[model samples]
Target: MEQRELGFTKIRLPVVGQGTWQMEEADEAACIDAIRRGIDAGMTHIDTAEMYGAGEVESLVGKAIEGRRDEVFLVSKVLPSNASYAGTLAACERSLERLRTDRLDLYLLHWPGSEPLEETLRAFKDLRAQGKIRHFGVSNFDQAELSRAIALAGPSEIACNQVFYHLLERAIEHRVLPLCERHGIAVVAYSPFGSGRFPAPDSMGGKVLASIAAAHGATPRQVALRFLLRRQPVFVIPKAARAAHALDNAAAGDLRLTSEDLARIDTAFPLGPDRGVLPTL
Candidate 1:
């Protein structure tokens, strides 16, 4: 797998990591296997959130990286409701306990909420100082909110901005992505396969994707992930609950799409100019 520096930080992450969103207690074994498979394939950046399965996924992540922690670049998020200075600290501690790690590679604010930005940023700074978290960032933040976050935390403090980005959802390209690039914030793209809602291989958009996939002997999922990885400083974390699927997703990092293929994809899925309201879960 290919690695790139995260923002201005020295930390380098695989372009395609592993995402643990809806992983539950019932699927614990499978989830752990999937994560391990991804790690084994060099997809060391593992992302999870305290909100995921009510922290069950973090526990599963802990189990997956038990003996191989050094090889993983772990990331987790705190919910917006717990964004308060004190709450953030408490939430992080709880997440650490669940993840069975002393420190997190990156910690993110799950979304914008009622908490004052300054308060949340203060907690992040404190955590970094205490070595509880190496870096801090935000998820689902729009251009305006991101600018405000940068203003509050300063450019270097915000390591990355995780958002919903894919061929179908190119809204961030209009402003958010450019803004992050200028400020040196890494872009972590979630739902790269449209949260499993991607068009069929025979559909209008899928036909174009299929053609590109055929040319590279890759799956449509891999083609989509390759497109995102080609965008420097951007990383994609697509969820895969099965080891086979995890390996397949990790392999996408090695697939290279041609400029002609990119042009065709762009034509099939035109980028909308509207930097409309950013979507959130």
Candidate 2:
């Protein structure tokens, strides 16, 4: 799999990773097997969150990565409601316990919360110092919120911004992406297939993707993920609760699209005007 640096840090991560958003709804053994399959396929950047299934998802991830923890780069998020200094610390500890891991590869504030940003950042710094987490970042933050976060934490300290980015939602390209690029912060694209809104194979955009995927001997899902990775510093985390889907998503890491393919995709799924609207967290 292709790799990119996380922010300005020395840590490099796979271009494609695994997301465990709604995996809790799937069969427990199957979900665990899916994650293990993804890891074996080199999609070792496993992302989960405390908010997911009220921490049950984290426990599942823990089981999936039990003996293979060192082989994966683990990430999790603290809920916005837990963004306060003490809350963030407490939340992380709880996540660590649930994940059955001593340290996280990356930890993120789920989104902008009512708590002071500095307080949360302070907790992140302390966590890093204590070896509780290797790096820290944010998710679903708008340009202004991201800028404030960078100012508070320093550009190099903030690792990445996990956001909603797909053919249908390209608002971040206007400002958030540019800012992240300037600071060398990796843009971790969550829901690269639009969170269950992926176009059907017969749909216009889907047809374009299907054609492109066919040309490359890949799946439309691979085309969508590769589209996000067309940029130099972007990572994608597509969820796959089934082992087959996990393997399929992992293969996208090796699929590269041509310029013509990209042009066609662009025409099919134009980045409509940025209305300054951010996707829901």
> In terms of lDDT, which candidate is strongest?
2
Each model's RMSD to truth, in Å? 1.1, 0.9
User: Can you write out model 2's per-residue Cα lDDT over 1-281, one digit (the tens) per residue?
Assistant: 88877778768888999999988898999999999999999999999999999999999999999999999999999998999999999999999999999999999999888999999999999999999999999999999999999998875888999999998888889999999999988899998998878989889999999898888899999999998888877899999989999999999999988899989988898998878867864
Clashing pairs in 1: none
TM-score, candidate 2, is 0.98
Could you tell me the lDDT of residue 155 within candidate 1? Answer: 61
Candidate 1 lDDT, 156-193, residue by residue in tens: 88999999988888888888999989988999999888
lDDT of 2 at 131: 100
Summed over model 2, clashes come to 0
Q: Distance (Å) between predicted and true CA of 174, model 2?
A: 0.7
Please estimate how well model 1 matches the true structure, expressed as its whole-model Cα lDDT.
0.90
